[model samples]
Target chain A: MNHSVRAVDRIAPRRQGNWDWRAAGNFVAGGAGGGVLACVAALSIGLGFDPRLLLAVGLAMMGFGLTCVWFEIGRPWRAMNVFRHVGSSWMTREAYVALFAMGTGLLAIGLGTRPLVAATGLLGLLFIYAQARILAANKGIPAWRHGRCLPVVLSTGLAEGAGLVACAGAWAAWWRYPAMLLVPLCAWRVIAWRRYLAALAADGAPVGTLTAFRRINSLFVWGGNLVPVVLAGVAVLADAPILAVLAGMLTVAAGWQMKYSLVCRAAFTQGFALPKQPVRGNSRTGPGVKPGWQWNRWLTD
Target chain B: MKRYAMVIDLRRCVGCQTCTAACKSANATPTGVQWRRVLDLESGEFPDVRRSFVPVACMHCANPPCEEVCPTTATKKRADGLVTIDYDICIGCANCIMACPYDARSIIHQPQYAYGDQPIASEAARMDSQHIGVATKCTFCKDRIDLAERTGQIPGRDPEVTPACVNSCISGAMHFGDILDSDSNVSRLLAENESFRMHEELGTAPAVHYILDRR
Candidate 1:
């Protein structure tokens, strides 16, 4: 190939200042890890007697999670003004949705309306979905780009939320539906775990600042993925709600690790291609270069 | 209707953060509120260092995601193409906060003080408690613009009131005008340079255009 030496030397080393490593790590760990724990807490609360009351408690926990998000910002107080750009802000939408979900859940509990609870539950699901979408929307973060994994993770989180609640609900009433729901939630968690690992493997790099995402992912597979599945299966076979609760806690912990790994390992890179140099002795360097002395000769020859 | 927009010539911008300061002063933004921020993105190795300052604010997109999600309809884009929030209707819910890609918005939980007000000042304590718990940001100095236009005191016989940040810009890097007008400075810059909007792929269609200082 008649490539100019200038072309070969054009690849410059890109520099990143400390890579916002701490902030990035904290963001991923807090967002994903906290999210999973919150989900588990919500599920456990929801399963308790008076699902509506539990839903309210779960929603309030979500509100606390919002505070964690604010802590990530340089100015937590100014978080309110975010509505100023509501016409163009996704965070605003997420906030409104969360508030609505919380309000509806509260109303359902206060008024003792099952229909309202179901409706709010559906909206809460959407709220969680939007949360995932918001993260995925960040093109700058490569780890969040997995479109497929987003919904899967969100649904799994929702299921985990419901499973925790179901375990509590079983104590109130001998309804096995919540436990049965755990079966699919567990399945979704596995699917999401597989997809996440596959994505990490395919990309050859975990997104963000955590260089050890793959290792963390392996831990999640063993702890979150395998343990939860086996325990839940055992709980189902044994007809033991206590065993189920234990398994659910394991699932939640593992999910948190998975979320942390996702955010911490994401990487962002500039997508522009560098300019190319013309081959020497070619007539194409008509105006810019001097004859018999090629531009970037120091690099070329 | 005039669609207000800003064109930043990053090549000429020294990254002095003069505009950021000017914006803070003009808007009377609180301690943690930053309507404008300069992101110093450093690329290339030490010997071949290249840094670009991306000063970001609200993009004022045509199809704003925040509006779509706002339950209170507190945020609305005016017919003139400026996105404004009705603070009275805002419920302090941080939905818009989470949705912003540029991290442009902030909620005000404390009182904002000017240069004269000290912590022990009697007026400071009173004023502090009054403005506490309100969401605030740059209205493009909307009050000043409105006052200037209403009083017919605008410079050069131009009927429109110019934003304070644009007026205080020393480098002339920030140009704001009606993007709808073909002869406007923002339009002219867009015609002349390879300007690009931030996060264009998200389909927010932000009004602000940046001429990147690619070294």
Candidate 2:
């Protein structure tokens, strides 16, 4: 146990800081990006999907999202009780919205009702937005503190929703309209990525450590932001559904990477100056012994 | 409608983690898990050395981010401003964990148990253990509050029902009361001291306040 403790103590410490904006930005990107992919997949299955099936899928996604949340929490079983604070807790509000949205989506599917689906879809969009807003509310995280993040996330949701609708349209051979929506959504994604990148480049560096900031810029700014932009452009030009879907997939991966970089890298360090060096004796000594020098040497110097 | 809040004077908080230990025991938090934590924050350098102990727990904010990101409506706040979790409905989702800025929440994926002789029945222990995989946080001892209220002893008004952390504070640095009440000890202290929240800029309207060491 002592040896293990010593070993653990020897491990190098990493930088600690807040990367709220970056995390929020990436979350927006993921929700919007993943939403688009899901929409595309739904469309590809044909708009005639059984309302039940659609509801099931949507609910499943919500459940999966919940699992992610639970995994991140300190106590999973206690999570249910959080809803008790729905009136005051943003978490409760988000949870209620998610549950309501899933239920609505499920009901619409079960009834094969267009109005219900639309309502559910709208609620779903809001659910995603609520997730974004939750992160954006944290001003301590500079990356997530901007007004633009909320709008950007909302737009991403729209784009992704449109893409899903388009996939359904494609299967139904009703491609023209959904494609029109996808074009703008893809464009918005590009613009948002650019803006996020610019912000990160300008302010990514935390107060003290240069290494962590550089890592953030290189990993997130380049890998997450740049790669996705290039891939998205190629997909747009290809004008192929497969290409678009592939680009969307890459975008999600990049977004996750961005999130990881933000979480692992951002930190705050206390600043301090080094102490002055002490004067040394003039006389040289053996490796094992202290140096001995005459007092006269100090006087002469 | 009780409004519970904690005031921590950073000056006298020795970071002994007694409050943390007391919170864990009161809450029965698992080993290697902490309901309250003390952070050792060092600033400046060498001759200008400054070290501060930051003891943290759930802020029980007026607007909690964890509540906003839950998809299953599992996490909630009480009328008394205590943020709590319901184990039964939780789907093991970690959305709230990502949403919290303070990292106050933890997801229990595995059951924890006492190693000594079983004082409580196995069934009861199993029932308690079933709360695994749900999000957990400091409840400000809601169970204690409930017990006290039932016995005609409301916390803040009665010393017996006060939170374990507040009662165990040796330096009188930890204060708990209603932030809404004008004459409450917490409010009076805030009025007299230069107080600040951990992340006031976030605007989550945290109820927990801090008084830093001016000296």
List model 1 lDDT by residue over B70-135, tens digit each.
545666777766677776566555445434444555676545554544553543434433234433
Provide the global lDDT of candidate 2 against the true structure: 0.55
In terms of lDDT, the poorest run of 10 residues in model 1 chain B is B122-131
> Interface RMSD in Å per candidate, to 1 decimal?
10.5, 12.2
How would the docking of model 1 be graded?
A: incorrect
Off by over 4 Å in 1: A1-146, A169-181, A193-216, A237-242, A252-301, B112-131, B147-160, B212-215
TM-scores of all predicted structures: 0.63, 0.61
lDDT of 1 by residue, A246-270 (tens): 7666666666556544544433322
| Candidate 2 deviant stretches above 4 angstroms | A1-146, A151-186, A200-301, B112-127, B151-159, B179-183, B213-215
Candidate maximizing lDDT:
2
Error of 2 at A4 (Å): 30
Q: Considering the two chains of model 2, state its CAPRI-style docking category.
A: incorrect
